[model samples]
Target: MPSRRSFLFAASAAVAAPSLPIEAQHSSGSGREMKQLPPAIAALTDRRSEAVPIKLGEREHRVERARGLLVKNRLDALVICTGTSLTYFTGLRWGQSERFFAWVLPAKGNPFVVCPVFEEGRVRERMEAKAATLPQASVTRVYTWNEDDSPYALLAKALKEAGIANGRVGVEERTQFAFADGIAHASPTLTVVSGTPVTAGCRAVKSTAELALMRLANDNTLKVYEAAWKSLEPGMTNRHVTDLIGVGYERTGFPGDASCQVAEYSALPHGSLHPQVIQEGQIILLDDGCVVEGYQSDISRSFVLGKASDKQKKVFDIVHKAQSAALAAGKAGTPCHAVDDAARKVISDAGFGPDYKYFTHRLGHGIGMDEHEWPYLVRGNSLPLESGMTFSDEPGIYIVGEFGIRLEDDWVVTPDGGDMFTPQSPSLEQPFSRA
Candidate 1:
């Protein structure tokens, strides 16, 4: 599932007629009107000290690596617009707007930026801050255009000046279509190709520092989930649990959120906007995670409000074994699809069977700076697993109208196999208990 922020934004328009409870609406209590937090949630302390932001040196190294990839991919320049890719390579956290603001990294020269003339000061300020940490903090050239001027033309001219005229230029996968089209129109001789070869090529594998941040992110998310799970009470709505998760992340000093799907809604993977109230023996599934230093963690935990029935236990065990099977098959050099096959086999053998009838979605997805990124773990993907490559080991069995059980844990590929950041959920009753 996507982040709660995105999901809620998309689901806001579809909210049901029923009003949310007071506890679900407000995260923090105000004076006498403030509702008490569950002991488990209230007891959480700030864990900001455990997180470490990515260093400028590491980002610089990433750029150098991208340059080599550019040469290998036979591209002259790479155009990166505002998004995670831009932040991943440059460490500049700029928001995307109608106005054009981009970074053009040529394979052979210092990188440059193209932005609206008025925004130069703000852009340079951030660039200077990052440059301060570099050994060679040379001033990168900036090309600015007025409100009336076409930013794409300026970008094309800048590339021409940088000796990239009439060469193959790669447009980052996420770049806006208009921007890519404008660049192509302005310079018809320039070949605009997919930059995924260079971008995903570099991001597919995690560095030691990146892994550390992801590890902390996963750890923080697990703690938040456990606290929220412990705080769950019968009669409380799904929104209450979501609010608890938000509060738990606040205690950890990280921005995070989650989506709570109850009972029948749990069967619909991403969940529904319909108001749901918790009840005894009902299934509750929480999805999404927190971001620590740009790296993200995606985890899902499914459990029962009170005592779980035999059917729920059976489904949970099958999913748990499938998750384990996928992890075991995800060794270095193994084909990515093989991992999915391993998990699907377990679910299919248990009667959830026959290709996506009950077991829905891919076994997992590659995750890092973005929740869903490149090199997915799905059927027919021939890419071989490599050490340091991280992915979600999520396998699920969804039965329409009944309930769904999905076990997800962020794991990294190892030479021998894979290692999960946290221990898997052993059973529905004790979801967070360590085995």
Candidate 2:
């Protein structure tokens, strides 16, 4: 049976694919008669150097932005317990395990880290490598705890030093509940609140630099998708198509963030457990992206193997119209959910479900350091679209036991309205054409 890749795995699967995923082994339909490309990336050469990511200055500015959010949210301090939030503010990359690894950022003073005593050197090395300043980034103070000791006590002590011992402390929302509970237990006098307002405030909006990276990432993903599409041949499994894209990304000098679904399995949005193979005239969906520096890209294009059927073209047109409507409605003043409403309107007018019955998901999601982030384009979210904000403009139509069509592009809100990082699909025949 084919397995559905979870979000984390789906987003970065291309980056870490040593080989085709387990889903590839289960086969379905036969492929079409077409020219075959090299199956392995070993024969291809990387095409370009990677672009630089969010720089030292940008990282520093992000911290200041986060501080402003802290004030607005009435948080005296914020506790970042690993993950993207830590990387976003401090430029430090670390994962959360059983051990306590956290950054305590006080609204009034310097930030401090509570780390393991045995792991100090490596952490310090990473801090030095990634820090915006000469000595450090926000991780200026380091407090250590031995395994025999309580790391939570050290973290609480840091908070006390920051004068937030008895005040409101914002906890990174993604932090494991058990870890948050442990911290609360250790710091009896502290009030813990959600840090999302602070985290999302700093992250949702894209910088010029981030947008450039995204532009490059999206452009390259389309190129990879086009290459994979052209290389399809009769008898090639879905795994074969996936490998072609993987090679295209490698040759393009970026870690791939993509995968493919063939035939009826294309009806499933993330993909289906049904082992489906490529065949002539079957709808094929290539959904993926690559990281340009720290920022990322997510673009999905669906097309046919042979000639597209009338139904295929109709569904594709509807979804494309929905995507275009959402893009056109995007502006600085539009509410996040308003975009979804706009897109949903197009699909509904075209005879789909009145609401989410056919569309199934939101219009799109905020896209930057993460594939799916804040300021989601869902119903009831009123976050105003901002000039620097970026999101995926993807709309899909799924029909049971048949096929699905989704055309995705990365887009950013402009001073006037919004613009795509790459053009939307021109047509199934010439999806990459500017013409």
Candidate 3:
């Protein structure tokens, strides 16, 4: 049997592959041509046209905000390597390698970059393209080093020239240890610290444009799940359902995928590697989501293959109520842990928990460009909730020998309360509405 991770990777790759004609599409795992798609999948129409990419102005605003945050955090500059923060600030996406390529943004002056000599042209070309979209773009200085030279030394020199020789510099949270260590070694006078206060401070809150993209992503994922669920058959395996989800996303013109956990395997939070076959009265858990214009959606839905047992119905209702309780507790200014506490309490009171006896994971996680980000909704997190912060409001109950039920939807914190991007699932038999 294929490992769960490998299966998920294959499914994700299939979803990301370019769309082919319905007649030409094949199963990513089996290599068998998908000659006929389910009616629900076949009926899906392209929704990509509705998505709008993030504008250069928004990114400039983000950089300006980051600068303000850097001042507030008392950091003279922020060193951002290849990661989400890089793209978040500059709209440039570059992969990481052993060699260093970093963008250093100071709180007071223009930003500069240090990269391998061979990649300077490529990096500048991309930056130029991004700059063209701006109303009044300024040229960013580039500092290059050959393979034999230390990029960290070049970075240090750039900082020194920018009047930050001995000043405190913040390193973006995801920067590699070697890079950070090298910088520290190259310039012992400079103080290095976590840039999360600046990076997360700027990224935790969503703008109207970001929220719009996320809403579209969640909307698309929920629709794909509903359609895939409608196409389920008694004899189909979990792999078949996974394929359906990938194809559903393809038809909708977005790259997405999901993992299906059937029956007892659902008891595992991330599910088991053992192959699972669908049967009447068995529970099926589907998790994961898709990306739209750099934003992401994470959703999970659990339902029965056919008629649910009384016990299953009861568990589903308990989980559903817990989810709602968590959402209600997610008001602005409330501590992050409060939301988790509220949901855990409901499950515990329902006799399924006693503090993690049944509910396995945190209520939810922060969602945006990354599936999981800052300000997690979990126990002991004292971070206060803020408006425009988006998170997954998921609550679940898992029984080792039985089945599990999870209901997840993306929600954004508003001044008054919070709002879900997609409607809550109604029931195992009718998870999605007819209308």
Best by TM-score: 1
After aligning candidate 2 to the native by TM-score, how far in Å is the CA of 369 from where it should be?
Answer: 0.8
Residue range with the least summed lDDT across 10 consecutive positions in model 3: 15-24
Superposed model 1: Cα runs more than 4 Å off = 1-5, 9-34, 133-137
Write out the backbone clash pairs for model 2.
31-234, 31-235, 32-234
Candidate 2 on 124-239: residue-level lDDT in tens?
Answer: 89887775532245448889999898888888888888776687888988899987888778866887788889998888887888778888888877777776666667566665
lDDT of 2: 0.77
lDDT, candidate 3, residue 324?
Answer: 91
The TM-score of predicted model 2 comes to 0.89
Those runs of model 2 whose alpha carbons end farther than 4 Å from true positions after fitting are 1-50, 132-139
Per-model lDDT: 0.86, 0.77, 0.86
Summarize candidate 3's per-residue lDDT along 1-435 as a digit string, tens digits: 133434665754455334332335555653333558888988888898999888878888888898899899899999999888888888888898999999889888889889999998998788888884432247578899999999888888999888888878899888889988987788878888999999899999999999999999999999999889888888776767777888788878887767888899888888765667789999999997988988889899999877999999999999999999988888999999999999999999999868989998999899898888997999999999999999999899999989999999999997676799999999998889744
Model 1: colliding residue pairs: none
TM-score of each model, in listed order? 0.94, 0.89, 0.93
Q: Could you tell me the lDDT of residue 344 within candidate 2?
A: 94
C-alpha RMSD between model 2 and the true structure: 5.4
Q: Compared to the true structure, candidate 3 yields what TM-score? A: 0.93
- After TM-score superposition, the amount by which residue 135's alpha carbon in candidate 1 deviates from its true location, in angstroms, is 9.0
